[model samples]
Target: MTVTDSATTALSQGWCALSLLHGRIETHIERALQGGHDLSVREYSLLDVLSRQHSGVGGHLRMQQVAESVVLSQSATTRLVSRLEDRGLLNRYICDTDRRGIYTDVSEAGLALLAAARPTNDAALREALDEAARDPKLAPLVAAVENTHHDGRA
Candidate 1:
């Protein structure tokens, strides 16, 4: 027998719905960034975070810090940074205070790429959000997602 929305179930519909929504948004952002800018959403996020590190004198972040900020595993973050470095988009260096710690700062090229891609990325997100808001059924889901982000729980 097949179960439908009217049937009793053990699964949480809310969680499943949110997970699907997240997947769709992720795909949308990934495609928009990659197709238009030749950059992945993860790469854009990394560059964006590095560019915002004004608290650091040289606008750098430790590799660990970058991993945490970008929600990438340490090894994955290292590889991604290496890829960006190879593209001349960023520079990796050893921290002055901690010889074993590595840090990365966005290069001029990285900043320019991010600047160029920002509009495309922003437009895609705005369009997705606007569409969600227009759908009465999806509006609450979008609101919940926005609230989590604003509350720093995202």
Candidate 2:
């Protein structure tokens, strides 16, 4: 094969591998959600973010921050937060310092849902990690995907 052809083939293979890995992770998360958790992966992600924020000094996360962290658009994040709020799982408060800013806090009900969903989330993640760890070549790929944009600078 020519050098150009070889490079193209390698790139195509990499794309295929990444797609397959993404599909597997999506399936695992879907299973976790459907196994009586009643929470979509996005919802679980939002809840997880809120939980960690509450553990920090502020006890809340701005909507934009949550959107960025979860890879959702601003409108999508607002809708997701609305759904959670409707379920009494979260509370939205306008920022006192920034009038245009909105912050979300996990409600008691939200915390309860997260607590109930923790086992399933933990098990799914552990299973995915363990399987990936079995293949040394896959571990770095997984880590890279997980930390794609997680540098200290933002």
RMSD (Å) of each candidate, 1 decimal: 4.3, 4.3
Off by over 4 Å in 2: 54-60, 129-154
* Per-residue alpha-carbon lDDT of candidate 1 for residues 25-96, written as tens digits (9 for 90 to 100): 777889999999899989999999989986447566777788999999999999999999999999877877
Candidate 2 steric clashes: 0
78, model 2: CA deviation in Å? 1.0
Cα TM-score of candidate 2: 0.76
- The model with the greatest TM-score is 1
Error of 2 at 37 (Å): 1.5
Estimate candidate 2's RMSD in Å.
Answer: 4.3
Model 1: residues >4 Å from true position, as ranges? 1-11, 55-60, 134-137, 146-154
* Candidate 2 per-residue C-alpha lDDT over 67-134 given as tens digits, one digit per residue, 9 for 90 to 100: 99888998999999899999899988887777887788889989999999988887887687667756
